[model samples]
Target: MKKRAIQILLALSLIFYKSTWFWRVFNHLAKPYLPASREFFQILLLMESGVLFLAVIY
Candidate 1:
């Protein structure tokens, strides 16, 4: 039960991070430093997808 809740929270966070509005806010807040680099973004996307997949399967 605890694990499931944690997974749900993580999935939600991932979805939020990938959202346009979230990025817009993030970019606005942190003007000088980018939120994520290309490589980092790719890795984050892969990790988020993998976690969501595992969550569904589990």
Candidate 2:
């Protein structure tokens, strides 16, 4: 259980780091494509939600 908790935390951190750069680019390039911007935000939110859920459940 302890190891699993650590793993979950690490995974969440990695996801955050990976998303940071992509998110910045998405914000800049997505102005011309509002729909894609919305979709990108939705996906990011979902991933964050999953990370939160894992933190709670683990």
Candidate 3:
């Protein structure tokens, strides 16, 4: 069950990876709480996706 949820989340992130509007909205919403700029957040998300990929593999 947990693995399934992780897989679904990874899939969604990958699907939205190419959509600029998706990132824009996320950046806007997260701006106040997180100090990360758009580019930094994008990189952070990519790193998270990589971790999720590894988790799914193992």
Candidate 4:
């Protein structure tokens, strides 16, 4: 049972690591089309903050 649990954990970790790596490569390739403006990041931050605040309140 311990060996099985370890195997499952390793499998999940591998999947997550690979998916993250793939997305990083994809993001790098798509970076040119993505917004690079400071205003864009600021807006994203404000949006996330508002969402989190609302979540906590409600």
RMSD (Å) per prediction: 6.1, 4.1, 6.9, 9.8
**What TM-score should be assigned to candidate 1?**
0.39
Report the lDDT tens digits of candidate 4 across residue range 1-58. 7876666666556655755665577567767876565356556655755654455444
The candidate, 1 or 4, that scores higher on TM-score is: 4
**Local error of candidate 2 at 45, Å?**
5.7
Error of 4 at 16 (Å): 1.0
Model 1 weakest 10-residue run by lDDT = 34-43
Best by TM-score: 2
TM-scores for candidates 1 onward, in order: 0.39, 0.54, 0.46, 0.50
lDDT measured at residue 38 in model 2 versus the true structure, 0 to 100: 71
**Candidate 1 error regions (>4 Å):** 1-36
**Relative to the unseen true structure, what is the C-alpha lDDT of residue 24 in candidate 3, on a scale of 0 to 100?**
74
After TM-score superposition, the amount by which residue 18's alpha carbon in candidate 3 deviates from its true location, in angstroms, is 12
Candidate ranking (TM-score, best to worst): 2, 4, 3, 1
Q: List residue ranges in candidate 4 displaced over 4 A.
A: 33-58
What is the number of backbone collisions in each predicted candidate, taken in the order shown? 0, 0, 0, 0
Candidates 3 and 4 compared: the better one by TM-score is: 4
